[model samples]
Target: MSIRQPVSVKFILTEQTKQQILTEQRRQIEQLTAEMDQIEQQGKLALEQAMTQGGSAAQEVRQQIEQERNQRMEQREQLIQQIQQIQQIQQLELGTELQNMTVETMVDVNVGDDWGMVLMGSEIIIKDGIVHEIRRGGQPV
Candidate 1:
């Protein structure tokens, strides 16, 4: 997997791609919700027409309306799930806290090396996302 660190190691997260996708999804849900009202109206009209026709026709229309409502509910649930997933991904993407250094803005990158060292007041040895060892000034790594 790619870590998505900054190329200059002096940047922060400012990408709007994920956010933009989330916005689009929200817009879609809104549109679907608006359309759901129309679906309900159509179902009502179909049922009323069937009632005038009597017997099996009315029953069939009822079943069809129920099925259509179920389908719309399922679609709404799926949209809700997708929105939740996108929110989770966005949170995970923003979760990294770089306490030692601050980068104003950055991009996603893959660090090929397994181990890295940063010399502050101490020699900080890091592997993966964990700080393994911190040797103070004048101490060997």
Candidate 2:
């Protein structure tokens, strides 16, 4: 039997091949740089257009938003004033109701209690059946 040997080959670059590869790499880099520059220029143009053409629109929107906020604040203030007026009316009604009640006596429930029974004058103020402010002997208590 006869044995055959296979041939092995090695590749090497000459100066021309090396220069060709470098030129291709430089061309690719230049192409990519040109593409990036074009994209940046387009972005700048778009931004300038938006700032110039849409400026008045943006200002109008901002003014509308501010006006709405002021309106809401005014409404809230009016509502708060109405609530205060209502509370004042309620207090007056409570005072009138208390004035109608008559206290028969001011007896001390406990003999040695620190808080003795309070004496009510001719006029008194009450809310929810609880005495809040009172006048004793024509003086506020």
Candidate 3:
């Protein structure tokens, strides 16, 4: 505790050094801006060339996109039609089979207005062999 010791200190950038660093950063930013401008110009030139050369490439790509869209739409329509056709066929087949089954009596049954007849047995209620109702199991006939 007799002699005092000097405290160690870290060096910091002076104002001149800070100014130099800022100048370098500005120079780098200007260089990058110039490069970006050059790249954009090159892209524009390429697009111009593509446009001048008959423009067939772009047209072909557009046609391909349109064709693919049409194909998908056609496929979707076909699928929907197929589903509808299958449903119709199933309904017709079931109705035919139901009409072939015999019922004990056709009492309390109307040609087209009997909910009880429509829910009873595996019978397709036919006025004259024309299907009026489709039924399953035995509820009421």
Pairs that collide in candidate 3 are: 121-137
Candidate 1 achieves a global lDDT of: 0.59
Candidate 2 weakest lDDT stretch, 10 residues = 2-11
Relative to the true structure, candidate 3 reaches a TM of 0.30
Clash list (residue pairs), candidate 1: 4-108, 4-109, 5-109, 11-103, 11-105, 12-105, 12-106
- What stretches of model 2 exceed 4 Å from their correct place? 1-53, 94-141
Backbone clash tally for model 2? 0
lDDT of 2 by residue, 1-141 (tens): 222222112112334433443455456555555555554566455556656769875565555545555654565565556555544544442224312334343333345633322322224554443554555444565
Each candidate's root-mean-square deviation in Å? 12.9, 42.3, 38.1
TM-score of each predicted structure versus truth: 0.53, 0.29, 0.30
Q: Show model 3 residue runs off by greater than 4 Å.
A: 1-11, 53-141
lDDT of 1 by residue, 28-129 (tens): 888778777887899889889999999799899888878877887788889899899777667754434223352332222346532342222333443333
* Candidate 1 error regions (>4 Å): 1-14, 94-141
For candidate 3, lDDT tens digit of each residue in 13-109?
3344334434554565555555555545665565566667767865655555455556545655655565555445444422232212343533334
Which residue pairs in model 2 clash with each other? none
Highest TM-score among the candidates is held by which one? 1
